[model samples]
Target: MNWMDTIENNNSVEPIEFNVVKVDHNISLAEAIQLSVEKSGYEVEFIETFYGIEMDIKIPFLVGTEDDMINVNITRDDYTITIDIDIRRPNTIEEKLDILEYVNDNNGFISFSWNNEEELSLISIWMSRERLDAVDMLLEHRLINIEMGNAYVNDDKELIQEKLAQRGELEVYRDEDLEFNLSGEWNATHGFEYRYILRDINELINAIQEERENILRFT
Candidate 1:
């Protein structure tokens, strides 16, 4: 069965575990990056510019039923790989704090910056060649974080919670454990939303992994 069918057939109550493909550490950083993206079923593009030749790759993620792209740039110097996703500026101090906290929490792998002139918030993931195997996981994480950033932009509390839970930043209660009070509070009424969000997130993750596996299988 295909990945979607696999997701549909998944009945286990455990978290999904992904298999890491072994990468050759002896290879040059550029070659390692090229191999990793290629193995994940993405094409590596070489573009000529005034500075030098640059490597670029575009990966897709799902937003509702629509697809969005995340651009990854790989450079040889210092073996750095940069992933960039632009989000809207936060409208409130609370929103700004939320974004800052998320970045600080994942500071080892992510950083946030705002372009006041451009009126945009930039979320970036940086990694060295040593963590080459983590590229896929980081890509997935970045996409979820982008969704969270946009959630803040749109002032979507439910979506923000869902994204935080997906990243394990927030606690999620089991269906049986949720105690609903009659006050119609946010937690009481929306506690069950996370279950559905988790289900969708799992499906999206599985779909991405399947796409990579299919690409590797034929190539």
Candidate 2:
């Protein structure tokens, strides 16, 4: 058909749609990110220039007493986005530092780790600016990714003392026993007696603050 006929018949272009596929954690990182965007309320597309202009953006958060903060950084890499996070805590609280972080890169491999050895536990995550918001907000909900920490357990073993009650030929028939169960299936599944890992509560707030400033530098 002639080009004119194609446009006249609304055939010059066709609607575009994507197929939904299901699979395990083996998809490419790009595809994984694209899926997140598509699943979200946002649409993914390549823009030559935003607003036909180029500028810098920055964000800031408070770091009070090192016990209140969080830092999120999103940077662009080629066509992908890198997410970086820094979870900070007060040195006073580090006396009991026990944490575990889980993260997923793209969908499978491609992740890192960081040990909070400054006696002031800190967690960090880094990625592209595009996925910054998704990741930053994700911090609240948590996204399984590179983790370098430990979570305390009831490992605080406590002695279990119990007295048994028994009656034999002397009286009648009644018996009782007692025991203690710890470090078993109950505390192994991720969340059973595992708390937030920090007693400061506000410590993460500060680490994220610095991260916000870092991310804002990109916006």
Candidate 3:
């Protein structure tokens, strides 16, 4: 699909024809933001809603203070990049997510969602995984399968044995703690918790970008 053409069709959105003859494609966030607002003579705000990304930049009440919660802090390890996003809310998350998702191309290995005494916190850090990337991924999905091998036996099949049968391949990892692996037995199945581990996605993308140049700045 021609995304540019699609954006042009929207009534609320229009394009800005800038003299990109010498503009660097990789402009800094602060600079790009400045240019975007400058294009409107500081009258209109700029937001990019391309693809699945939605972001908006609006001028404050010209004097009154407001909270700017979306903050991205990048730190460096030996061979990993930890982009810690201080998430506030979904609207807050959208801004940072859009920037990082665009920069990383939505290929972070370790993607996780959890609240850290904050609002709708979703932090994703990318690291370099070793030779176990493939196996780890397989195991991850397999674990999910084992957990949900049965779709509420009491609610549907009601065949615990059939559901437990799916754990044959995971016999090696089976044990007392994993008694529920091949068995449709839950440790009191009441609540469901969905955790997002962004490290895995980050590592996957980082490994894919192993040969690419990246700025690993330390602060």
Candidate 4:
């Protein structure tokens, strides 16, 4: 079943749909749509809709913070992306069963919203299966000499620092337990570029191997 069907059948909540942009002389709606899709790392296929032209794409959604796969359609009408969330509160056994059915029909989750205050930041693209498998193989064989370059500090630094302060470890990492060292660079889109230096290589290797199942599972 499609997301619209799921939302209508399972719950009464209507899908959120709003125009993100209006066709203007400076930037055509098509151009804006193309840019959005490219930045999101998702391909678009144009289709006719009553409103106007629409672009269809599937994107990953997580059950919680952890990487759990659930699929939903991201249907774009000119400048708007329509989304329907599944199972807001699975309070009953029947709802749990419905969720299972939803998972079977949907490609991945669509836990998304337009964060107007923060700007439209595109989602993270999962690592390719080949790359993940190679990383897994390296870890299994105890090949710890590797570098992942840098990662963006996507979480809240201030909150994390406060927690560490309460624990009396104002420094987030001890010298010996420094699994990776962080360095920062400012970027307008992502905010900061935190470079990583793998100190505890074995630990990271183990993590990579353990988390391998999440890679390309939706596809």
Error of 2 at 129 (Å): 16
Off by over 4 Å in 2: 1-39, 43-80, 92-108, 114-122, 126-219
Clashing pairs in 4: 70-108, 70-109, 71-107, 71-108, 71-109, 72-108
Better of 1 and 4 by TM-score: 1
Tens digit of per-residue lDDT, candidate 1, span 106-128: 44422333333355555554443
| Model 1 lDDT, residue 4, Cα | 17
Can you give the lDDT of residue 45 in candidate 2? 39
lDDT to native, each model: 0.36, 0.25, 0.29, 0.28
TM-score of each: 0.37, 0.19, 0.19, 0.22
lDDT of 2 by residue, 1-219 (tens): 311121122112222222333335433322332353355333443222332111111112232122222222212211112223344442343322222323222122222334456554433332212121222223334432224222111111110000011112112101211000011212111221111111111223323433343322211
lDDT of 3 by residue, 84-191 (tens): 433333345555554354345534343333334443443433343221222223445663233555333112232223334443433433443332111223311110
- Encode model 4's per-residue lDDT on 83-145: one tens digit a residue: 322223334666445445534443322122211123232222221111112232333454432
lDDT of 2: 0.25
**Using alpha carbons, what is the TM-score of model 3?**
0.19
| Highest TM-score against the true fold, candidate | 1
TM-score of 4: 0.22
Model 3 / residue 44 / CA error / Å: 51
User: What is the alpha-carbon lDDT for the whole of candidate 3?
Assistant: 0.29
